[model samples]
Target chain A: TLAAPAIAQSAPELKWRLTSSFPKSLDTIFGAAEVFAKNVAEASDGKFQIQVFPAGEIVPGLQAADKVTDGTLEMAHTASYYYWGKDPTFAFATAVPFGLNSRQQNAWMYEGGGIDLMNEFYAAYNIHALPGGNTGAQMGGWFRKEIKTAADLKGVKMRIGGFGGKVIAKLGVVPQQIAGGDIYPALEKGTIDAAEWVGPYDDQKLGFNKVAPYYYYPGWWEGGPMLHFFINKAKWEGLPKNYQAIITGAAALANTDMQARYDHLNPGALKKLVADGAKLRPFSAEILEACFNAAKETYAEMNATNAAFKKVHDAVMAYRADAYLWQQVSEATFDNFMMAQQRKKAL
Target chain B: TLAAPAIAQSAPELKWRLTSSFPKSLDTIFGAAEVFAKNVAEASDGKFQIQVFPAGEIVPGLQAADKVTDGTLEMAHTASYYYWGKDPTFAFATAVPFGLNSRQQNAWMYEGGGIDLMNEFYAAYNIHALPGGNTGAQMGGWFRKEIKTAADLKGVKMRIGGFGGKVIAKLGVVPQQIAGGDIYPALEKGTIDAAEWVGPYDDQKLGFNKVAPYYYYPGWWEGGPMLHFFINKAKWEGLPKNYQAIITGAAALANTDMQARYDHLNPGALKKLVADGAKLRPFSAEILEACFNAAKETYAEMNATNAAFKKVHDAVMAYRADAYLWQQVSEATFDNFMMAQQRKKAL
Candidate 1:
């Protein structure tokens, strides 16, 4: 019989634990972790296995990064922006108000030195990061009333997430930080006037459209929000180079899969919500302009105080300018024409 | 000493050859094949090795798929539409006139039943297809003179690639199938009135701006053209399940990487092309509308004669309508706003 190859003989059996920031109920977001785990195990021939746990099963969702950093967990899948309270720089790894869109975000991360810059900052926390998924541009929120102007936002209580609340608060809106499970009842019972979740597919599951008749779009705060896989640096450095490459490739697959899944599912969900009497609206230009200005102010304040935030912010803004310029010339033009055909039902 | 595991002992030593339809000089397109090969080797710890050869190294560029189908090559990296003359249904795997954009293509392929539909068609040819890369939306082409109206195309000889030639032939334009190496000389000598290769990055390498002053926006025919990894069905099935999973994940990585590279590189390339005296123009609404109508006529003719073509085209069109409707609501709106900011240098 032929001798087994030296490399094959050295293949070791190991198991890892991963904590997810989202519950399994939100399959599109939470499912990315499962996809990553499945690919890892399959590629390793079950020699390496990773067990996934949903939010609160191992640690609370917001504390996931802490668990990974302190070596309590091997990895955690969560949004980087979820940890902004610990350091504002974490926001750039996921998104900031008026940040890059999905394609732009991917381009920046993969080719525009975003990964290097972000990983440099993450190294200080004893962690390494890889982009796990993106939730394309999200809807503004489900609202009980239409917001026709910036003035309409004043004093309205809303359930919002992450750093978005800081910027919106500058506009006189009361931003509530409510958990995903609590958002529905809070809106339905008049505790909050409006609430923002993810896009149509995920939001539809929570039944936000049933109570709030007005559905608004183009969630400026979370435009192309990305989620990340945070790995403990010590654990990562100890892995074989082959396993490292497998993990990197698996993360890339999961990253692309989530956005594709969302794009495929959101269309049907949006149509269903509208058929059930949800009124779709675009935030007026006056309101978007006000929020854009407010977001700038918030960024300026952070930049003045946080050098880490400033470095990433400067790099992102520079890339943003060029990415949009190129996009307008080709992608936007092609898409605009296709959209007109769809409206005429000519397609 | 511990005994070697049964699975590790079973790991086989294998080598496969992959032929690319692109030359090495066009690094972004050809480089995806390299990326795929690198990940496969790294993931399998050099046990499963794939050697990549550029166009003509094994067979001519256009014959890549044929080589894989006949088992002359184990796999190939090529645009599926290159084989449209064999069957118009192959065009759906890559792109079609006025079809889905990059994001929508991935969504359709990964989530909207495109993989199953295309694989079913490919099964007849003894091939399996996986998306390997996308070039995003392409530029219209380089023209010696501006085409201000549909009438300007009359009797104009243009060098265009497969499938698009058939659609554009309806507009009274003469189409020439010129090789990449010969396009510059043809344009410089007025042998061809216009030629298109790809968007800015690849196009810049061809130095088309030196000969043709008029560059145009939006190659409507090749919107989000995807390249595929075509594998021999017998060879694919014989691989261990671990190897199959590794290949699948690698292809997904390559697919996402290509577009990200294009998006990152095109911006600077466009700026360089403009500075070097390339006059940019848009295909007027009148010209685009004429070509759009002509494309519809061509598709109708194909649908009437070809059962496979009709089935795939119908599915794409149905999904396309809803995809654009949702995109216009969020993505287009947000991108339009960012572009306006870019124009004002406000970013």
Candidate 2:
């Protein structure tokens, strides 16, 4: 049974500003906001408009969340982990070291109680969060020289993200937090021995391969990091239900689209990098083992000290246990066999 | 600038019927249509409503696509590959043997030109398609006895879907197409030696574990089988832009949610099955390799004769090549290591 159509012919137009934590140059990351805005506008028949501002255009990249929470901005598109310093629990919202990959992350957020848990934590800041985008599993930054063992990390200054840096630091490596735009120069000038950004698509855009020839993979830190659209609680609640639905739809579309773009673009970008003399290498089992152990210790320490972090960490670990079991049997088995077969044929 | 919302308050409410190819008892699979309909009505403020009909309510399950195209029903929720009997190219729209996993399939459909190419093919049938839901990577199937080698498949009578059955038929297997509601009885009565439904979640509901004690995994044939929302071309185009957006948003939500629900539910369901004296087994490497080989030969033969099938198959294979490479380096590495660690800890 259908209800009578109730949309008014002269509904007033609504406009809002969205601030992103990424600069325009990193189009894929920051560009997701524009994609959300454009879809919203087109879907609403141009009646609802959102103007996107790149990182510094409104608030600095890392401060977009604070602006949104304070209602200085209506919403923000930013990675939640950028604010992990405020509370380690923030890392759970975006990603944690060695956490779920993109699909599992989505499962956690949508089904495994991640959204409710994260939102309860975020409610303290007067905001609502929607998963806006994901940048598939990232590459382990670019390295100037191959890393053969855990001992090789000693005194190696690497530009890594916040929580991952903390975890890796225990492995006798120096971790530095540098802005996205500044990572290239730090790696080029030998200020940092290695730097990790996103995957192949973003890495190529930043020209990291040209400066660092050993392109290592499996960014153990930011496995399927998700971008969030943080809305001011009051601002979000005041909208019509239809408008809310539109926002939900637009955000989901953007979320799915962003990863698809990365999956499509990264393969080509990687080939180009390899063609230009970039060597593809996997992090040695020894180093990966070292990092994994260190990551566990770091999580343990954080849980012992921070109750907020502990609550989310416990939940994530439980969900991950089941998820990992299922995926290993299904995804890993099929992929491992198919990849080996495809590679052999190519050779 | 926002234009005046031109919707009339007294606009007539629109009502449509959606036929689904799945029985209502399989809630997660068939329930996706209900979820889509509910979201659409709520998002549109109840002005647009769709009533869902389970298989055999209005037409047989396999006839959903034809009903939608003929406008006997405005829409249908079904897997595209169900119609592969009509056109082998139809299999590409859902899943084919050894096809992309859930994430890779989404990437190909949304970003890698899969939608455009598939739509071009669908246009000839006067139908429009949307990625509706996914079952993730499915289990191999329920078997009466363990299959230890490719030789074990000789003369075995198994219930399989259309295209997959064709591939396995080459390896000395007798493939039978049985209706979903009849599979359980067929397997129970020894009329069919083995059967494949979905994963643990759906199989448990169908009560297959009671008869088939051996449960094998990695449904290589239906890796990430996607359900499609088929709309009569004229009906879709006549919808208002805002309504169309709502449909897109609702469909995307259902698409993502269905997979999450399955992923979340399958783990628990599997645990229950194992506890109930069910034996979990992996198809031997020999059988998997043989099936993989047969699948390839089947594709090559089809491509040599069917122009339409080749057109889509070539695109899917090319896209698959690149997708496999990237996922291998990123997703597989992370998942394999993490799973191994978790298993070690458990042991």
- State residue A206's C-alpha deviation in candidate 2, in Å: 1.8
Find the candidate with the highest DockQ and give its number.
1
Per-residue CA lDDT of candidate 1, range A217-277, in tens? 7899978999999999999988887788788889999999999999999999999989988
Cα lDDT tens digits, model 2, A36-137, are 888777767677899999989978888898998899999999999999989989988788888888888888898889888898899999889999889988
Model 1 interface DockQ:
0.82
lDDT of each: 0.91, 0.84
- Candidate 2 chain A: worst 10 consecutive residues by lDDT? A1-10
Q: What TM-score is obtained for chain B in each of the predicted models?
A: 0.98, 0.95
Q: Judge the docking of candidate 1 as incorrect, acceptable, medium or high.
A: high
What TM-score does prediction 1 earn? 0.98
Which residue runs does candidate 1 get wrong by more than 4 Å?
A1-5, A8-10, B1-5, B8-10
For model 1, how does the per-residue alpha-carbon lDDT over B1-347 read when each residue is reduced to its tens digit?
Answer: 25456455435778999999999999999999999999999888888899999999989999998899899999999999999999999999999999999999999999899999999999988899999999999999999999999999999899997888888889988989999999999999999999989999999999999999899878999889999999999999988888888898899989989999999999999999999999989888888889889999999999999999999999999999999989999888888888888898888
For candidate 2, what is the interface RMSD? 2.2
lDDT of 2 at A100: 80
lDDT top scorer: 1
Rate residue A330 of model 2 by lDDT: 65
